[model samples]
Target: MTRVVGKRAARRAELFDQLVGLFLDEGFAHLTLDDVAARLRCSKSTLYTLAESKDDLVRAATVHFFRRAADEVEEALARVDSGAGDRVTAYLEAVGDQLAPASARFMEDLARMPGARGVYEQNTAIAAERVRTLIAEGVGAGEFRSVSAEFVADVVASTMVRIQQRDVARATGFDDAQAYRELAALVTRGIAR
Candidate 1:
C-alpha cells in the first residue's frame, strides 16, 4: 500500500485517513462542510481545499475508502496460507471482516450514492474474477469437483452483490458480515466434493 495520499503531499494523506475514519463512523452523505471542518480541526476553506462541496467530498471519500478496502482484501487473500478452497473462504471472510465496521448508515449511503455504487460494482467485478480464477485453480489441482468455474464464480459474485443489497440484507435480517459467513459455507459446501 503506497501511501493513499495519491500525489498529494504527506499531509493530505493524513487528512484523508482521518476523514475516512470519520466518514466510516458517521455516514458520509449526512456530513456537512462544517462537520468535516470541525472534526478535522480545520477551516471550511481547508475542507474546500480537498473537495468542491459536500457531495464532492462524499464522492471522493467513498472512492478512496472503496479503493483502500479492495487493496486490503487483496492483501488479506495473499496472506492466506491454504489451498484455493480455503483461500476462497478466507477471502470472503476477510471481505466481511473489512465491512464489519461499517455502520448501517454508511452502508445505506454507499447503496444510494451512484458514485460509490460504481466503485463497489468495480470491486465486485474484481472479486468475481478472482473467484473464477480460484475455482479454476482448485479444479486443476483435483481439490474440487469438476464444475463450470465461470458459472460458479458468477453465482458466488452475484450472491455477494445480493447480500449487500440494503433491502435484501434487511429482509433477511443478516448484516453484511453474517451474510458473507453464510455465503462462505453455502459456496464451499456446494462446490466441495
Candidate 2:
C-alpha cells in the first residue's frame, strides 16, 4: 500500500512537471491535453485523472510559477546582509528575472485569449502591493523619505506593466532587467531624503 501510494504521488509530480515545462516552452495556448499526454508518452485517461481539464492544468502551472516567484521574493526580502534599499533592489531584480521570459510568452498567449487578462491583472496588482509594502517598511526604517507608499507602489506596478506591453518590450530591446534596475533607482531617489 505504501509503495502504491508513493508511486502514484511520483507519477502525479512527473505529470505536473511535464505540463509546466510544456506550458513555459510551447506557450499554453499551443498545447492540449493530448499534446501533453503524447509528450509524456502517457494515455489521455492518465492525464485526465491527474488534471480534470486543460484549464486546470494551465491554472496549476501558473500557480506553480507564481508560487516559486513569491518564494524567491520573500527570500530576497529576508536577507540580513542587505540594507532596505539593497533588499528592494534585489526584490525588483528577482521579479524582473522571473518576468522577462514569462511575461513575453504570457503576453503573447493573453493577447489571443481576453479571458486570461483578468488573472494577469490581478496578479500584477498583488505584486504592486507587495512592492508598496516593502517601500513602506523602508520609509519606517528611515531608508526612504516621506512619500505616499501607495503612489510609489502604483508607479512601480505601472512601470512593470508597461514593460510587459508588447511594443515597449520590443522598444526596450527585451532588456527588462536594465529597465527594472533603472526604475528601482528612480524610485529610490524619489523617496530618498
Candidate 3:
C-alpha cells in the first residue's frame, strides 16, 4: 500500500513538472490541459486527476517556479565569498537570471485576465515576502549592508519584474543575456553599500 501511494505521488510530481515546463515554454494563457496531456501523451482526465482545476494548475506552476528560483538563489548566496556588496550583487544577478524569461508575457496575461489578477497579486506578495526574509537573513549575517530589508527586497523584486518586462519587449530587438547583465549591474550598484 505504501509503495502504491509513493508511486502515485511520484507520478503526480512528474506531471506537475511537465506542466510547469510547458507553461514556461508556452505562455500560460495560450496553454491548455489538452496541450499538456498531448505533450505527456496522456489523457486530459489524467491531468484533471492530478490538478483540481486550471486555476489550481496555475497556482501549482507558480509555486513550482518560485520554489526552483528560491533554491537557485540559496545556492548563489552560498557561493558568494565576498563582502555584503558582492553578495548583494550575486543575489540580484541570481534573481535576474531566474526572471529573465516569460516575465513580460506573464504580467501581460495577468493584466488582461481579470480573474487571474488576484492570484497573480497574491503570488507576487508571497514572493516579495520570501525575498524580504532572505534579505533580512543576509543583513543579520552581515552579508548585506544595513538597509530596510523589506524596502530593499521590494525594490529588488519590482526591478526584476520590470527588467523582465523590458526583456520580453526587446526579445527580438536585443539579446536577453545582455539586457539581464545590464540590469543586474544597475541593481547591484543601487543595493551595494
Query: Each prediction's TM-score against the native?
Result: 0.89, 0.81, 0.70
Assess candidate 1 and give its TM-score to the true structure.
Answer: 0.89
lDDT of each: 0.80, 0.72, 0.64
As for TM-score, the candidate ahead, 1 or 3, is 1
RMSD of each: 3.2, 2.8, 4.1
lDDT of 1 by residue, 25-104 (tens): 88778777888899999899877888887777777777777778888888988998888789878888878888888888
**Pairwise TM-score winner, candidates 2 and 3:** 2
lDDT of 3 by residue, 133-186 (tens): 756766787666677888877775675455444433455453333444565566
- lDDT tens digits, residue span 81-160, model 2: 65667767777877777655554566567545544444556666887888898889888988888888999998888887
Residue ranges of candidate 1 with Cα displaced over 4 Å: 1-8
- In angstroms, the error of model 2 at 88 is 1.3
Winner by lDDT: 1
On TM-score, the stronger of 1 and 2 is: 1
